[model samples]
Target: MSPACFYGDSSALDSILGISRKKTEGALGQHPPSVSYVKAEQDDLLGLQPDEPANPKVLRVAIIGAPNAGKSTLSNTLLGRKVFPVSSKVHTTRCKAYGVITEDDTQLIILDTPGLTSPTKAKRHNLDRSLIQDPWDSMKHADLVLVLVDVSERWAHTCLSSQVLQCLSRFPQIPSILVMNKVDLLKKKALLLDLVTELTEGVVNGKKLHVKSLSRTHLDPARNNPLPSIPACTPENAPKDGGCLQEGSEVQRGPGSDTSCDAKASDSGHVLGGTEKAQTATPQVSRDGKIKKGWPHFREIFMLAALNGEAVETLKRYLLMQAKPGRWEYHSKVLTSQSPQEICENIIRGKLLEYLPQEVPYMVLQETELWEEGPSGELTILQNLLVPKETHVKMLIGVGGQLVSRVAREAGEELMNVFLCDIHLKLCVKLKK
Candidate 1:
C-alpha cells in the first residue's frame, strides 16, 4: 500500500498511526471512513526490520546508557513491570538488565546494559568516572542498539563524550538510536536536537564517525498517560459476509459529530475511526466518491503505546508487507536468556554494584552467612555489618547506646521487609586499623 496521509480530529492522530481507534472514539466520536493517500516520505524503520514469512519477527534491541540516565525507566516502560532496580543514585545497575515484549505471536527481547567507560583513568584525571567497557563487550553482538543520554544533564564532561564515541565505534554496523533520557528537565528542544546532530557525527579509534538517530525523547511525556477511552456504542450496523461493508454496514460518528474532519488513511491498517476490538475498516467507496472511515482498530493502538509500540493491525500489515507468511517465527517470542539463579549470582558477584562508591563515605558492607527456610516459605538469615576504625564504630554506637538502637532498628526493618520473615539480624562494628 502506498504511504497515505490521514487527517481528522487532532486527538484522532494519536490512534491513527501509532495507536488504534476504538481506543480513541470517546475523545473523537465514531465516524464514516475518510480515506486519503499518505503523500509524505519519512523514517519508517519499523518497515525495515527482520521478519518471517507472513509473520512479525521480534526485534532484539539493546539500550546502553550512562549511569542514572533513566535506562531503567525505558526498560520498565517497555516491560510494563518493575523488574530492574531504579534510583536517583548513580550506578544502580551493575549487570545487564533484560525485558521482554510479546504480542500477537511475536516476542521482542530487550537488553539493557551497564554504562561503560574507563573509570580508573577518569578518577586520576579529575574527570567524570567513565562507563565500564565491559557492557560494550556484549554490544559486539546485537541486531540493534540504542544509546541513551540524559537530556537533563548538559552536554559537558569528557567521560560521557568518550563513552558515547566508544559506543558508536563498537557498533559501527548495527543501527543505533540515540534516546535523550530525562527530557522532562529540558524545555529547549534545540539542546536535544543539537545533541542529536553531534552524536550522528561520533568517532572511531579517536577518528570522526557518523551515524543516524532512530527515535528518542529526553523522556517520554506520555509514558504513563491515561488509556484511550472506548466507545459506549458500537456501529448501528456491522460488516457483511466477512468482507467489505455490505448493504447497510454504515459505521457512523457519535452523536453531535461532524464529518468535516479530514479522513485519515492510517498505516496502522485500520479504516479511519473504527473501533479496534470488533472489526478492521476497509475504506469502502461511497456513491459520492469520498471515502468514509471503514477500519477500526483503536484498542490495538492504545495497547501498543502502553506496552511496546506495535499495534495488532501494524503487526499484520508488517507481516504481509514482508511478503513472507509463516506459521512460526523465532525472534518474536521472549526467550528467557538468564535464569533466576543466574541473575541472583550476577548480583552477588558485586559486578553490578558499581553504584556503591569505592569508598562509601558513610556506609559499610554486610553479607548474610546462612539462610534457614521456615514454614510458609519464609526465611531467617544472619548477617554482620563490618566497619573499620574504633572511633567510627563508637560514634555509630553513640553514648548510652542511642545510636546503636536507631541503626539496629533500621537494619532489622530492612531485613524483615526483604525476607518477609523473622530476621534475627545482629549488629556489631569492629574497629580495624
Candidate 2:
C-alpha cells in the first residue's frame, strides 16, 4: 500500500456496541454498527513520496497567508461560493473555516487558515477561543499548504509573508504553492511572478500600506452607496488601502468591474509580463452565460498558473500532486460517515445540554457537538457553549430566561438557511464556573 493511499478495513472492524471500548468479537454482529480502518502501502510513512500511491489516498491542502492578502477571496473564488468571508479590512477572518467540496459524492475538505503572522496576531484583540484558534490547529491536519501574498501592497508591510515562505521552503518535499494575491493593484506584474511560481512572491522592498477595518456596509455591494460619478472617488485599480472605503467615498469600484447592483467596477487590468503597461478591457459574458470580471494581477496570474482541467479540478490535482508520503497511513475513508444533518443536529443538542449564564465568572470555552433531526422538518442541534470562569454565571443569565430565548431564535434562523428547512435550535452552557 502506498503511503498516500488508504485501505479502509472493511473486513476486520471491531465492534463496541455496549457503550464502551471493550473486548467484543461479536462487534460485527451489532446492528447499525459502524466500523472502519485504513491501511497504507508504504512502511516508511515519512520517507520520500511515491509517484503513485500504492493504495487509496487521502490528500490535504491548506491555504495560508498573511492578513488581508485576499486568501479568502481566492479560496471562495476557487470554491465557487461565499464559503469564507472576504473583506477589505484586515483580520475580517478570525479563524480557520473549512468547506468540503464534493464531486460525484467524493469529498475533499479544504481548510482555510487565518493569516499566519510573525509573533502571531492572537495576542491582540478580544478574540474568543472559538473565533480564531481553529486555524492554528488546522496545521496539524494539513498535507499541503498554499501560501497567499497580497502583491498590491508594499513588501515592507507584509509582516510574516517572507518568513512564512522561508518556513515553507525548508520542507522542500512538502509540495507548496506560493500565491501572489491582490496583484490587481500593482503597477508592475512581472516583479511578483517568479516568486509566485517557483518558491515565494513579493516585492523585496516594494511600498505597501496597512488597511483599516471599515463598516460592514463596505463589503456588501447593495449597502455601499456609489462613488461620486465624477471620479473624485479615485476609481483607481485597487484602493491603496487594500479596499476599506474612505469617508464621503464615491463608489470606489476598482478595475475588475463588478456591476452587481447600482455600482459598477472597471474591467480587470492585464499584467503582460516584463515592463509593459497593463491593459484593461470591458467585461464579457462567458459561454456558460456567467459574467466574468477582471481579477487583479496576482489572483489572475495565479489562476492561470494553477489551471489544470477546470479551477476546482485543478485544485484537486494540485493537492494530489503535492501529497506527502505516508500521510494517508494515518487516515481512512469510512463509509456511512456523519452527514451534514447529523452534524448540525449534534451541534444543537450539545448546545442545549451545556446551557449556562453569559455572565459566568469562571468557565472559559465551549464547542458544539452534534445536531439531530427534529419532527415537522425542523432541526434539533446539540452544542455546549463553554466558559472559563464559573463564577460569572448569575450575571450572564437574566430574568425570565430572556437571553436563552433570544439565542435560540437567532441560531435557529441561521441554521435554517443552510439546512434548507426550518430549525428548532436548542442550547446549553457547560461551565466550570
Candidate 3:
C-alpha cells in the first residue's frame, strides 16, 4: 500500500471524527522527505482500485489578509514543509505562489498571495502591481478563501482592514473563514471572545450568537492593561532598534496559552449587531445590503498560532474534509509549483529582509549569475545583488563583507535543507547606477 493511504488506521478515524493530534516535537520542525516521482499512468500503486471513480478530490484555498498576518507561515505549516519564505517584513511574498498538499485522495492547492493593499497605497509606495492584483486574482480560482488576521497586533485585532472588508464584499459567493492568527501573543484571553464577536459580527456558520461575559467582580488584570498601539510591522516602518517581533518568537509580557471561544454562548446582553436578542440581530449591512465592518458570512472562525503549528492540524483536516470531487492538478509528490530559481530568489530575499535594516532589503534587486549542479549531486548558485546607490552596496556588503556573508551562509543552510543537498551559494553586491 502507498504511504499516503491511511485506510483502517487511527488517522483515518481522526479524519472522520474531525480530531487533530498534535505533532511530535521532532516532527513539528522537520523538513519533508524528498521522494522520486513516477508518472500517474506508469504508476498503479497509489492504493486506488482499477475500477475506482474517475474524479479525484481537490481543493484550492486562497489565504488573504493584510501584510505580516502569518499567511506564508500558515501555508508552510499546512503543507508540512517550508516551501514559502517568511520574515518580519510585510510584502515578503510579492506574488501568488502555489503550494500543493496531497494526502491520500485529496490535493490542497494553497495560494499564498501578496498582502492586500489599496490602490493608493500601492501607487504611493511604487509597489509591484501584483501586490494589489494577485489577491483578487487568487480568489477568482479559489474554492475557499481564508481571511487571516493578526489578533496579537493592536491595530488589527479590533477590526478588519478596509481592503479585506472590500474583498469579502466583492466576492460574496465564495466561502470565507476568519482565521485569527498569533493567539499566543494575545495577553488577555478574554479579548479573544470580544475579538471574535467584533470580527464575525456575532455570526458564525450563518448563525447569530453571543459570548457569555465574564463576571465584572472577577475581571482579569490583563484586560485592564491592553496592549500598546504597536503599528503592524512592515518594511517601511520596521523598528531600527530590532524591536519588531518575528513569527514564533515569544513576548515576555504574557504567558502563551491556547484559547478558543465557542459560538454557543448565551443569547443575551449587548447583542453584537445592536439588537435586543440574538435571533433579531444581524450583521451591519450597507445601503446596498453588503457587509460594512466585518464579514458576517464567515463559514467558520479558526484561532491558531501558525508559527508553532498550534491548532493548524485541525484547520488542515477541516480543509481536507471540504474537498469535493475534481481532477487532480499536480502529482502527489509535488509540494510547490515554484521553480528552484524562484524559490532561491524568494529565500534569499527573505534573508535579506531579515538581516538588513529597514528599506535596504527592499531597495536591493537580485540577478542570477549561475545555477549549476556538481558531479557529486551538490548545487552551485551565483547570484548578484544590484543596488541603486553606492551606500546601499556598502550596506549590503557591510564591514569586511560580514553582513552579506551571514546572509549567504544562512540562506544557503536553509536552501540545503529545502533541496536536501549541499549548496555553494555565492552572492555579489554591485552598484546599478
Candidate 3: residue 91 lDDT (0-100): 86
TM-score of every model? 0.46, 0.39, 0.76
Model 2 error, position 320 (Å): 5.8
- Candidate No. with top lDDT: 3
Clashing pairs in 3: none
lDDT of each residue in 1-433, candidate 2, tens digit only: 3221010111000000000111223211222211111112122221323233354345555676666666656655444433344445455455565554322222345677666654444445444564345544665667666666555567532333444543443443444444444434554333332333222122111111111223344333764543211110111122433222223222222233212411111111111111112333222336874432211111111322221112233333434433333423222222122344433433333233334323232133445565555567565565556655444333334466566666567556534543446665655655544
* Whole-model lDDT values for every prediction: 0.39, 0.38, 0.69
**Candidate 1 Cα RMSD (Å):** 18.2
Ranked by TM-score, the better of candidates 1 and 3 is 3
After superposition, which runs of candidate 1 have C-alpha atoms over 4 Å from their true positions?
Answer: 1-56, 119-131, 156-160, 187-358, 361-366, 381-383, 389-433
Over the stretch 211-282, how does candidate 3's per-residue lDDT look in tens digits? 444444444366644333222222223333332221111211112211111111111111121112224233
lDDT of 2 at 420: 48
Task: Give lDDT tens digits, candidate 1, residues 299-330.
Answer: 11111221222232222222222222223223
Which candidate comes out best when scored by TM-score? 3
Task: Report the poorest 10 consecutive residues by lDDT, candidate 1.
Answer: 33-42
